[model samples]
Target: MHNQIDQAAGLRKLKKNKPVRVIAITSGKGGVGKTNLSVNLGIAMAQKGQRVALLDADMGLANVDILLGLYPKFNLSHVLTGEKKFG
Candidate 1:
């Protein structure tokens, strides 16, 4: 099991040598599954041994973390408020 995990990790790292593509999906109004699609797509890419980062740019009301069932320690709001950097 450990060996398999190591191999998978190595492959994931190897895949990271290639550039990661970012795709942004936006909607003019709410109720659309933009966050859902973005989260799922990011997860799918990572599962396929690719590097992915999902950023929620909805300043007024961000929902990407909510849709992913994640309670982030900090968000873009913190960065904009000078609490964090662009990690």
Candidate 2:
């Protein structure tokens, strides 16, 4: 399918020998500490000199920025809307 080709092209664009790794922490219940765990884990990894990015995918009710005390001018929505690109 077209999507598969696009995915392959995207992979080909990545630097050789360097692959992307992703981790997801989720729970069925709200207010259970997913955000806290994500923040802490990201910080720990960064402290270890590893590249880390925490995405707040909660859409309308996002709170990771607040929890991290950050004010992001751009987010995934901007990227999805073609207003920005992941560099």
Candidate 3:
């Protein structure tokens, strides 16, 4: 189990160090399809076998995970509340 964790960490490090371009989509207003674009972009990257982590930092209005229909066991709120570390 420890070996598997180490291997996964190594792979993540390799992916981060790889020469892959990153794109950030932003909008000044809500309901502007920004979330949709980000979701599709992330999906495309992952489909291409690239490592991706989509963070929704909208505070009270975050919806990236919701748009993707993913129910995370823990979110930024948990970390902000000191329930988790920035591992």
Candidate 4:
């Protein structure tokens, strides 16, 4: 169909293995849905076959691990305290 051709023509292939893109979700105050939104957004992107990394840089709460139900065996704190090394 002509519609299918038009839709296919509109698509341009992206360059593979380029530098990683980062999406930072930040807010001034606390107790909003920033963590929830960022977590879901990252999941959605990964589900669509796009590589995704969500860094929880919130210095105060540091609850992204909790939202993801992940209890990391080692965190940056461990690295900073010479308890673990980045490999």
Candidate 5:
């Protein structure tokens, strides 16, 4: 009974979804430091315990992963293809 009650409360919390803030950094030229700014800002926010998702969709400058030096086994591509589940 206690476990079921706890799950019901957790579901309530999830239903009260928080507002999301999306920040995009863009530029038309290279060597303008957009990557550095985005990475640093994301790190600072994460340090403050804020959820941050940095989307580096620019193929020409897809360096967020490289800048953070993170070589993750899975990526957005895997998630999109249903190879992995979010949960």
Candidate 6:
């Protein structure tokens, strides 16, 4: 199918670009350990001197900052609305 071909091409491009490894944790039920695992893993990687950026992509229900107890002046919404940059 065209979709499969496009996906294969995308994967090949990603392989050639040698981007950093990406991990995605998904689930169907709420209150699972997705956020917990992401935070702990990110912290552990940082403790090991690895650069890490943990993004909670739950657009409608993001709580990474809440769980970490940090208030961010800007968030994905701000970026999407052109009030902030993705950088």
**Model 2 per-residue lDDT tens digits across residues 1-87:** 654323234435553557767799888999999999999999999999988868787878889999889998987777666566554
Model 6 residue runs over 4 Å out of place are: 1-18
Q: For residues 1-87, could you state the per-residue lDDT of candidate 1 as single tens digits?
A: 553323234336645786545577988888788888888888998999887778898888888877778889987777666556553
Provide the lowest-lDDT 10-residue window in model 6.
2-11
Instruction: Report how far off residue 56 is in candidate 1 (Å).
Output: 0.9
lDDT of 1: 0.74
TM-score against truth, every candidate: 0.68, 0.77, 0.65, 0.65, 0.63, 0.70
After superposition, candidate 2 runs with Cα above 4 Å error: 1-17
What TM-score number comes out for model 5? 0.63
Q: Estimate the TM-score for candidate 1.
A: 0.68
lDDT of 5 at 52: 79
lDDT by residue for model 4 (1-87), tens: 653323212112222436456577878887778999999999999999997767676656688899899997766565555565443
In candidate 2 the C-alpha lDDT for residue 45 amounts to 93
Give the local distance difference test score of model 5.
Answer: 0.71
Once superposed on the true structure, which residue ranges of model 4 sit more than 4 Å away at CA? 1-17, 79-87
Give one digit per residue, the lDDT tens place, for model 6 in 1-87: 653323235446656876667789889998889999999999999999987878898899799899899998877776556555543
In terms of TM-score, how similar is model 2 to the real structure? 0.77
Put down candidate 3 lDDT per residue, 1-87, tens digits, no spaces.
553323234336656777545577877887889888889989998999988878786788788888888887888777666566443
CA lDDT of each candidate?
0.74, 0.77, 0.73, 0.69, 0.71, 0.77
The predicted structure with the larger lDDT, 2 or 5, is 2
